[model samples]
Target: GAGVSQSPSNKVTEKGKDVELRCDPISGHTALYWYRQSLGQGLEFLIYFQGNSAPDKSGLPSDRFSAERTGGSVSTLTIQRTQQEDSAVYLCASSHGGTDYGYTFGSGTRLTVV
Candidate 1:
């Protein structure tokens, strides 16, 4: 895809269920990021994967939240034991290795845990 592509633009899951969000970044991008924005709140960083380096998981709210980038192109975010508080728009962005070219964002996946 020319732009970042996200699957299941919207998702509704029961509490305690697990969900996986997928992101396919533009070809050649070396940096991928996951973030979430709750109602009326600013974006909260979740995780970051750069090149071949180990992912930065510091921003993950809990141990149940994790993400992985496969072959440096596609990424997936998994949330185990979803909670109502986890409902938010999960956004994916990709950059060309640094802040120089900025980032290309995908239409986020809106996850609603009920």
Candidate 2:
């Protein structure tokens, strides 16, 4: 994909179920990030991967939230045992490196819990 790509632009799942979201970053980008946004709330950083080194996993909300980047290109975010409070827009973003470059974001996967 030329730009960031996210699957299942929208997802509706019952509480307690697990869901996985995918992200495809731009070609050659080494910095990948995930964020969660709730109504009236600004973007919350979830995690970041720089190259093939250890990712900056400082923003994951909980143990249930996890992500991985393979080939330093595509990535996936998995939310285990969803909760109603977990409903939000899961956004994926990527930058050229880690030096504050402009980030390109995915359209996002809107997850609705019930």
Which candidate has the top score in lDDT? 1
Candidate 1's residue-wise lDDT over 1-114, tens digit each? 799999889999999999999999999899999999999999999999999999989999999998888898999999999999999999999999766668899999999999
lDDT (Cα, tens digit) per residue for candidate 2, span 1-114: 688999889999999999999999998888999999998899999999988889989999899999999888889999999999999999999889867679999999999999
Clashes of 2: 0
| Error at 49, model 1, angstroms | 0.4
lDDT of model 2, residue 21: 96
Candidate 2, superposed: residue stretches over 4 Å from native: 98-100
Model 2 RMSD, rounded to 1 decimal: 1.2
TM-score of each: 0.96, 0.95
For candidate 2, the 10 contiguous residues with the lowest summed lDDT are 93-102
Candidate 1 error regions (>4 Å): 98-101
What is the alpha-carbon lDDT of model 1 when measured against the actual structure? 0.94
The most accurate candidate by TM-score is 1
Candidate 2 yields a Cα-based lDDT of 0.93
| Error at 68, model 2, angstroms | 0.6
User: 111, model 2: CA deviation in Å?
Assistant: 0.5
